[model samples]
Target: MGPKVIAFFLPRPPNYPMPFVDVGDDILLDILALCDVYTVIAVSAIDKRLHALTQTKQLWLSLIQDSTFRHVLELRPPNNLELQLHSTRELVDLIKRAVIGPPPWWPGGPSSSRTPSYTIAFNTGLEIIHDYRLLPGARYMALRGASAVGKDLVMYEVWTGRCVWGIAKRTLTRFAIDVVPGGTTARVLLALPTAYVGGGYHLYVEEVDFITGTSSEVFRLGFATRLKSLIAIVGEFLLYSLPSSDAEEKQVLVNWRKSTYVVLNYGTETNSSAILIPGYIVASHPDTSPPYQQLFTVTELDAFAPHWQPLTTISLSGQLFPSTIPITTQERLEYKGRPLGEFMRTHVRLSITPSAVYRGASTVMVYVNEFPKPRPTPTLTAQMGAFFRGRRQPEESARAALLTYWLKPPGQACGLRLVSAQLATPSFNTSPLTPPRAVLEHSGSSFTVSYYQ
Candidate 1:
């Protein structure tokens, strides 16, 4: 007791928080993986060691597998090889760009606050890009182009711009692609054109697995004078066009999986164009009188043949253009001495984001160009014909409107947006009649309108 009393009283040192930098690297990585990209970036600034630790490849790779964020980005699984080629910082930056909009400092950022948009270009390994298409949900893109070696049909991950699957051939080919429901893979129908020994061209349709990269000949059509337009691959069916022996264009609906085909013949309608939607094939043709645009639908794939069912016919004369704009200009334009109204034409361009899950329903964008009635004079007729054929630019008087129909969406009404009447011709460099297109991006949440000249 005496010894204890003699000892001077000493105050215990106050407890303080441990420095974050003292945490083990493994624990730090685990913590960062649970955080959003911004949190990780903020933590990195606390200490030099943390700055390096936050850049760990393992940390960013784990973040990419986060399911909630993946859905938001509409991300397709990145190729394992391509995934490793990018640095941790670049991967983090990509997540940031996808989650939040592009950096405000970007030179050409989003065009509008409501609709964020930016452009990124990656090498496609083609000398000339013939055509490119984004599969439904915009997770993947298909491209066909000419290369110095020959031709290339390729598919890429839209976000990373990495070629996931591709083939180079010595012959020209056409491709139609569709996602396989799961995000990791796709089904591609390739049309190969070859010279038949007898006379006309032979078309061999091959089905390819995007994951395995193996292909098999699904079917072949002989005596095709021209390569059919491979419009789309909807489920197990393929919608395309073939020229019949009678010199008439036949729209074909083929169940490539079943090895059976049906002709989408709207009897005597030579001007019809068809596009495949989820549960329907939408066909549009002009009506005989007063020149109305008619839309027809063919039901989903069935065990037997499907026939076209009339949907509705709409007149653009009074709806799109006002009564003041004459159907036939005052220049006394006549077709065979008859008023040119009889020669009026409606050109339809159809686009669809085929998956219904992303948008609550499938959305079909029907873009119609209502051309002025043509005069029978060889000069005027040829000029008007050239525009429709995509050989010349659309005239100032041509009218266009975008009609969006949400198939089977509960309680939602369809809407139409009128595009500018002074349609600026998209420069294809090779073709003048290519229409302005609205591309659905990032799982139907946003879209960008693009024009090519």
Candidate 2:
């Protein structure tokens, strides 16, 4: 309704800073990107225009692309998280917290040694759960039921407990998930047993795309119908174990992408536990007296031939075994007022599980739990007494320790270096009668342990 107002605009006040708001969004974003994360955050709070510019997803993504806080990202990976779900302030806060390191109450921090900082309950909707894996980045978890029918794999977001993807109608004999870089996709290798035309069952290596839920058969091999096996995938390489004809375990390494595999000679250790990383396969036989771990590297024999061989072996004698375990004696009295004593014998038994590996940092974490071997089946009265006590009896000792070993970097040594060791008094109060299963999550710098009944 008013006449042309181009000549009627208000005059600029003295010292009024207008240039800051006059820049194009592209130029402003480029300048903000050049600044450190904190500086950008500080600039965002200066004015509305600057704040809007900093809020762009492109700006935050650019910063994440150049961030060097890899270990921090591993602890809270961006898996299943969409940028639109978070605001600029939340994104900036994440980077700031990562730069400052995890807080004391963080599950991976020192406080976890005493008690868990927090807990999350995941209901599988099944009565029996066979096994579950907390996927890398701690964003999602995969679970398999103990039943052989109905359902196979169920994956859900860790925070919201939302079912993102699932597979039904097939039994997942053994499976491993490798979340590829950028958190855009995950690769799952499934070992499915199928009945052949004649009689015997053959296992198929089926690869599933975590994002789309599409599956394709990678390879097929004959496996002993009665024998148990384990499989792990890292990138394109797959490490699996099978029982040899001599009853010894055969460790096989396969690059499923190239469709080539080589059988590794692990030298007749039937009690070994093997785990796969990006470029290495670590196998440990903790049942032995002292316990030892072997590291095998995937090496290429030629352009067309790739094989894995023994790289180094590390002795875990003094580390995994505890030195001073408390010894206690139990005394039982005779009937009436007479004094009669009974002796109870106990010895420490050590067991270790290879928990996680920081691929780029060359670090590995192991969970060790040492407890006294139980005596013969106790009388009903004694069992009830133990139950009423609400904790482990004085005669029994339980200790849980975390051991970290740093693998030798390239072109240096051939042995693993002991980085840091943490020992804690384990409390199994959650499931006193039944031993609680421990779930360990490591973030390169620190690790967290969760117990499941």
Candidate 3:
């Protein structure tokens, strides 16, 4: 200690290689910023020379910035998975085995048809396109749900209000009104008909382009008929089951093909249950080059699939409303304690705004390949109610009231709160701490407002 000799120092190790080149941590960091993420990950895995680069937390942090890289990592590793599942060679086969347990479809594919029949679902509507040859000549039924999926093609439903006819390269006519869950209530748009019988007829509802649209309906089959006789079409239909309070949610035996579509009822769904419907499911194939078809679903290990054979790999995440709304995932893709099938419901109410009142007949139509076939005559009217939480009632009504609502889409950005308040007499003691009685939460497409006076 007294000599102050640096005994631990290796006297410059005689000639240990040359001098230590000082790339400097700062210089190395700058160089790291220059290289692409791919380069960084590659270089960081080598021996110490390059491996040291990864030790820099900033480099790894920067790598996370690329969305594409992050997404791949998210899907590949799938970290934070609380529910673990068995890995199989073919995940699709596993999914099929899990959901559609029994052999629901012929492994060979759909049987050859004569007139050509397509499978329809109640929740996700159906779409059938007939060439001009079958347009005015063929007799068929149209069915659908709320909206049409898959565009690059225009599918039209009937006009929602009164009857109207026009010349669309020919004489065209559309049936009025739409088919919704709440009996006679209609949406802002109608499910257009792809088939016209007895004469050349058509309904103009919406236009589109690249057919890539898909939405959910309530039924197992949602078909659309443009024919004025909606009652006749639906009344004669038995493929879909009517709503019932006593029924149980189960997979109904429908298609005879290897590809089977399933259904679930909202009125019958239980807690922790989901209704998983695959996306891009269709009965008809367009007669074109290299048919573009997709029907797949992915279920999680903890997924509530009672069966796990035929209907395993079904994915409803990308379907129209399923995409926007937080519907179920077959495997609970986010691990939020549910599979897709256990998530969706039949009857959906969407809250909307017309920039005006929902005076005239408006539609919130749902469809499969297209809009759901509309009910010819609508009898149910919209049911609306309002309440407020902080609103103070007056002798006749209230003094000052406040509304607390959990808004949904279409009218989500709108701050319009249903309130009624005047003033209480000076004698009556009212505190500002009294919360309003109004509570509104979004259910389906409509806002459900509930409160006590």
Task: Please report the candidate that would top TM-score against the real structure.
Answer: 1
What digit string (tens of lDDT, one per residue) describes model 1 on residues 132-178? Answer: 66665455666666342243876665554455666776465566776
Q: Rate the local accuracy (lDDT) of all candidates.
A: 0.51, 0.48, 0.26
TM-score of 2: 0.47
RMSD of each: 17.5, 17.4, 25.4
lDDT of each residue in 57-76, candidate 2, tens digit only: 77876675442333224444
TM-score of each: 0.48, 0.47, 0.19
Model 3 has an lDDT value of 0.26
Q: TM-score of predicted model 3?
A: 0.19
Candidate number with the higher lDDT (1 or 2): 1
lDDT: worst 10-residue window of model 2: 321-330
Off by over 4 Å in 3: 1-247, 250-259, 263-268, 275-453
Which regions of candidate 1 fall more than 4 Å away from where they truly are? 1-134, 143-151, 158-163, 196-226, 244-248, 267-271, 288-293, 296-298, 303-344, 354-360, 374-399, 409-453
